[model samples]
Target: MQIAKVRGTVVSTQKDPSLRGTKLLLLQLLDEEGHTLPEYEVAADSVGAGVDEWVLISRSGHAACRVQGNEDRPLDAVVVAIIDTIYLEKRQIYNKREQYR
Candidate 1:
């Protein structure tokens, strides 16, 4: 699993049948410092993660397929969890509970 920030969403009029009702989100990869890298990914949402939320992303095709319960679907990434907070030692670095509210 990897960490990413939900930057926006993706809407497609025509998609594979397996991904018909799946929510596609744009995600920016984040390093340990919470800084976004240059790479971005379009991931299928499994945990109902929204924009600006920190999410745990699975980049494995098998994992993504398992999340959607469709083995035939072609998926490289999927949002597995919506993070609430990140604690580095005794310091609270990133917290979404306060940001969302």
Candidate 2:
């Protein structure tokens, strides 16, 4: 799994039937240290993630497709969790709880 930031949403009027009712989100890849990378991907949202939220993503084809309960779907990435906090060693690096407080 990789850390990513939900940057935006993707809308499609015509898409594969297997993707119907699935939420597509634009994700900005992030390092373990909470730094943004130059890479980005459109991932299927399985955990109801929202923009500006830190999320856990599975990039494996099988894992990605499995999360949405559609193993045959053409998906490369999927949001698995909405991160509430991130800590490196003894130090806290990120806290989603603080954002809403």
Candidate topping lDDT: 2
Give the clashing residue pairs of candidate 1, or none.
Answer: none
**Candidate 1 C-alpha lDDT tens digits along 1-101:** 87899999999988788777778899999987688889889988878887888998989888887874656779988888998888888988788878767
lDDT of 2 by residue, 15-66 (tens): 9988888889999999999999999989888788988999998888878767
List TM-score per model, in order. 0.88, 0.91
Candidate no. 1 TM-score: 0.88
